[model samples]
Target: MSPTAAPTLRVERSLLRAGHGLVAGVDEVGRGALAGPVSVGVLVVGPHTPAAPRGLRDSKLLTPAAREALVPALRDWAAAWAVGHAEPAEIDALGITAALRLAGRRALAQLAEPPAAVLLDGSHDWLSDPPGQALPGLGEPVLPCAAPPVTTRVKADTTCAAVAGASVLAKTARDALMARRHEEHPHYGWAANKGYGAPEHLAAVAEHGRCSQHRLSWRLPAAALPPAPRGARAADTLQPPVGPGPGRGARGA
Candidate 1:
């Protein structure tokens, strides 16, 4: 879709006609952050749902202020909406994919009714549970209801109104959370970077070491500098890998 184009309900309307009374749009945020929780937002729409706000688009395409402004309208537009998060520790224990499922299920659980069908932004069906697969650290099913069938669309966040709204809600919610976390640990610069691989946040990790909020399983910045020389002991280094780090050419915050 063009950058200036607005998302439409065409895709959603199609699903509503496919014998599904309720259709949900699903999206995630903070999956790549060095700290903070991975969040998922679910927005349910039904046959009578209205068009989205005029400027609604993918969260990545909208500015922070624009996204913040759309939240109230988006929330009011949906039949039901909810946001959920999997903390850094959960990410470490269950890994990102499982964490995303956990967060998505949590959001779905908050809805007044389970969606008859789910419309996911990405091409991968990450939200559905594998057959006979047990919940890892969580130990129990996130929802008592049967899992709803999901349909994945690449770039749906940009093409689908409901998906875009979900992205905005998830992004704004996670940003607020990281901003609050920044108040307690000012050095991470989370208020601005939102815990992505921003240079300053990496530098802070390199200097102060990983804190409780950091995903300990992921490679973080080293706590100290390299060894003084051959005669000196080598300083400690972090083990978790930064998926896209400074050396790898950093991605957006």
Candidate 2:
């Protein structure tokens, strides 16, 4: 397929034909957000999987309204699904790489049953022997692990129904969390940007400084980032909340 088109479940079907009973399509959201935590979503789909709700595509492709409308149906269509998040403190403490592993582990642990294989979006295996650094176009992973095998593909979220489902779930869950947080910190305008680095969000950070929920390790607005230490390598000094998050406070549609 071309680089710009939406995806299908053909890859999931192929894996099913290979005798995989339950392949979980996994995807992540909010990894690039300037605030809030990262979220991972898992959706299990197999040969007998029900059709995804109509008009469901990559969560990034769908409008907030469309994603909101489809959230319940996606939850019902998957045999099993769950969303896991790594709070900003975890992200600051472990850096994004390990934090992602932590989040993915949490999501997988919530599954009703272990997946036969995990169909992860993107070309890098973020959950396998070799973790994906920046999701570079490294093909499938080769290392073995206690967990089920992982199959990574670029644009899997677009081409695989299971992965797409996971994307929607993660996006929806993360958005809900941001909306909830917005109630407490309306200055960030998270209700509109969902914690992304929108202009208003940057302005708020510049004016109000970072919150407990902001990732201290991530680059923030110019005024928010601490000045580089003199004679220190041009790298970060990494260090390490669920409130207003998805555990239970946020309402899902």
Per TM-score, the best of the predicted structures is 1
Considering summed lDDT, which 10 consecutive residues are worst modelled in model 2? 244-253
Pairs in steric clash, model 1: 218-240, 219-240, 219-241
Alpha-carbon runs more than 4 Å astray in model 2 = 2-6, 129-146, 223-253
- TM-score between model 2 and native: 0.80
TM-score of 1: 0.87
**How many pairs of residues collide in each model?**
3, 6
State the displacement of the C-alpha of residue 250, model 2, in Å, after optimal TM-score superposition.
Answer: 28
Clashing pairs in 2: 7-158, 7-159, 8-159, 92-239, 93-239, 93-240
Q: Give the lDDT of residue 40 in candidate 1.
A: 92
Q: After superposition, how far is residue 5 of candidate 2 from its true place, in Å?
A: 5.8
What lDDT score belongs to each candidate, Candidate 1 first?
0.82, 0.76
